[model samples]
Target chain A: MIRDITIGQYLPGNSVLHRLDARMKAVLTFFFIIVIFLCKNFWSLGLMIAFTLLFTAISKVPLRMMLKSLKPIFVILIFTAVLNIFYTDGGRELFGFWKLSVTDKGLYTAGFMVIRIICLITGSSLLTYTTTPTLLTDAIERLLSPLKVFKIQVNTLAMMMTLALRFIPTLIEETDRIMNAQKARGADLESGGFIKRAKALIPILIPLFVSAFRRAYELAFAMECRCYRGGEGRTRMKQMKLKARDLGAAFLVAALFCGVFFLNYRFKALI
Target chain B: MNENIIEFNNVSFAYDSEIVNAPAVVKNVTLSIKRGSFVAVLGHNGSGKSTLAKLCNAILVPQTGKVTVNGMDTADNGLTFDIRRTVGMVFQNPDNQIVATVVEDDVAFGPENLGVEPKEIRRRVDEALKSVGMYDYRLFEPHKLSGGQKQRVAIAGITAMQTECIVLDEPTAMLDPRGRLEVMETVKRLNRELGITVVFITHFMNEATQADRVLVMDDGGIILDGTPKEVFSHKEIIIDAGLDLPAAAEFSDMLISDGFNLPDGILTAEECIEAIYAEAKKRGVC
Candidate 1:
């Protein structure tokens, strides 16, 4: 059960999308999301879907992974479909059964909504799947650097995010170790009542809490010994750079956004 | 070499709640360790050897006594940082002790803590990694490295700090056999080749054989203190304290009692083989 939990999943690749500046990718993703929502009719939506598929292809992320991500949201899709099918009111009524009615408008609304949602998820997942977590946090910090005006301590925040991302795997491993150790001691974690289940968790929690505090203490001591007083005058080995391709990709995204938004508006007018 | 680089004067430490059903961990322990030497502290589990190592660097101060490193009192708040800088510690778990994801970064961490200039930090990191034979792993993520490699990186972290002495608390306890050998070799090289003072804490008697001196503790008391040969000679006392001898040592002991002309105090396979061959030659059997 513990092995199945994938934290901050990052798949390494040498694809063009992976090579782009993280900050640009993050910003482009925002603009891309807006484009998806603005696209309404089939022509504009078709254009956006083509664009998403193109990026997805370039990223080299498998289609199966995208599908797996949507697995959890299948319930949401079904719920929305059901709600729209019987409750939606409009367009020529197709059938009537006991107080429930199915309309042509309901069928169309449900179909478009599900498709839109699936595209939205599949499109944004590209950013996370292709980019490393460290790079993603680095991009976030660089993009939010303007908040330094409010004394945000951007480097500290980014460092925290990077460390947090780095430690997620470590903590998961530790949690597994603690759970196994407790189990070896005959502490039942499964097949127990509500109160018993809670009681069983204490053995795992105590050691984990102790270990966490111990790690923090060691880290603090280590930092102090290194004279690390918090990111002042610190230079990075890998300086974040913005390449020509990064800007080119952002511009391409912007152009797509403008084209889709206007085309959708025109398509809505025709309908 | 100075006979006393570290002097603990009339030291006694009870746990904070010692008066209330709490046992004292180190009781009235007073000793001095020589400078420019490799010393191994031997004890069974819960023998207070770890607590003593902690005191050497001011990680824990004595409740009733004083520890002085090169004449500087460790308990003095003004000198605590200096004392720590003087004596670095490598812990049991190499996985947790490493501060950076990358090997070089982890090695550089200790130097960085010293507020060294960036250029010096780079130089020290490279030198330390090279000394530990991990220069090639500089770019590797620490978690991907094997147990021995991670421990070596942790040692490099302490080495880069340029501490005069290193105190390792069971550095090989979690390691496999090969990992244990690699770490022990590295520890010896740092001590003998680099002339750095080494205080190794371990339950492995074979590891203790590599050191210049051995200090054995039993039940919060100093049971035996001498060179390896002198200490291991009191074999009965150590075993009585519930610590087993290294395999080679045990084999040598059995052979000795069986009147096989084998020499005493064999600690490693190489040593045992050398002694057995010499005996064969003496008996004209080989």
Candidate 2:
């Protein structure tokens, strides 16, 4: 059951999007998100959708897997759609109720929001689906290096992030082992109230925490044994260099941003 | 210059030296590891074997005496980095040692920390991985690897640092039999082919038999230290140290008591087999 998580999952591929620089992909994803929000009408939203789908297709990640990334956010999507349908007002009223009314504007707004959200999720997940988490964190470190002027420990933060990403699967496995051990000892974690179930997790949590601390202690020694003395004077094996493909990707995203802005201005605004 | 890669001069350490009269974990242990020799340390739990391994690389500085790695004193604060770089260490738990998600990146971590150029780090990473027979799994996630494979990768991490000596603190303890064999073979190759000095701490008698020299620790002191054959020959001392002999040695010792003229110090199965075959021929028995 714990294995179902797809966050930070990378599908190995050699597509153009996959080969794009991680820093460029990250920047473009940020810009694409802003463009999605800047979208003022269905025409612009539709263009954003097309842009997202085109990149997804270029990434060569399976469509089903991309959709699977949305499964965890399904509840939020539905909640937003419902709230917009009932709360938003304007245009001709289509249905009426005691306190809430559905109008054409409300329906249009709900459709726009749902589509906008779908595009936002798919666009960002595309970056993760193509690039390994290591590259993404490396990109983050380099991108945030400028913030060092503010006395920020950007390198330490990035190292922490990398370590967190590296240990997620390991800790999950540890949790699974602890849970199974508790189960074997006749601990009732399955059949109980919410509070009771949470109480039952105490047995699992204690061991997990203990083992995690032990792991941390050993890991510190191991890192030191490897001559790690913080990020100062440290060089990376994989250097992030911007290639022609990165520029090409940037140009493509820029084109999408312009098209969205043009459509937002050229047509009548709809909300 | 001394031929020893590591020298311990009456080194003693305690986890709680702040307390009045805290018992030392390592008690005045004076030892030297030769530049290219393979030394295995055998002891039960809480016997200071791990402490000795830590002292080699300055992970734990000696409280009473001194430890020198490649002729540099570990007790000196400024030389700690250089000491660690000279004597790389692989801990018992493989999962805890890996710093990178991917195998190649984890192996590159040491060289990266030492500020080697990117191209050299890549070259060393590839060479280290290939030497450990893990080049095929360079792109693989470390969590997906078997215990032995992860341990080998940990060794490769140390190998990439190009350290002259590697101290493994019970590397095969968490592995299955096959995993143990794989790690042992990889370690053997690294020692024999690459000429890396190894200080392996393990309780497995069979593994100790393969080492060029073996040290038996008891209550934070070296009780026995000699060549594997010379060390295992003292059966009473070994049994009294709360350790067992290798299976071949035990069987051969029993056969000798039964009047089969087997030679002493049969530490491996092949040696026992050859001895028994020669005995049968001399006795005119098939």
| Top-lDDT candidate index | 2
Docking class of 1: incorrect
TM-score of chain B of 2: 0.98
The candidate that wins on DockQ is 2
Tell me the alpha-carbon RMSD of every candidate: 4.7, 2.0
Interface RMSD of 2: 1.4
lDDT of 1 by residue, B121-203 (tens): 88888889889999999987666678998899889989988888888989999999999999999989998888889999999
**How many clashing residue pairs appear in each of the predictions shown?**
4, 0
Name the runs in model 1 displaced over 4 angstroms.
Answer: A1-6, A40-44, A81-112, A137-238, A261-271, B1-10, B17-23, B27-36, B68-73, B76-86, B99-146, B160-162, B192-195, B219-226, B233-268
lDDT of 1 by residue, A81-185 (tens): 888888777778998899999988888778777877888888778989988766787678778879989988997887667556545656777988989888888
DockQ of 2: 0.77
**Residue A150, candidate 2: alpha-carbon lDDT:** 95
lDDT of 2 by residue, A1-271 (tens): 5544433788889999889899999999999999999999988988888888888888889999988999998999999999999989678999898988999999999989999889989998998989888899999999999998998988889889889988898899898999989889899998879999999999999999999999999999999999998878899999888999899898998999899889989999997
Window of ten residues with lowest summed lDDT in model 2 chain B: B66-75
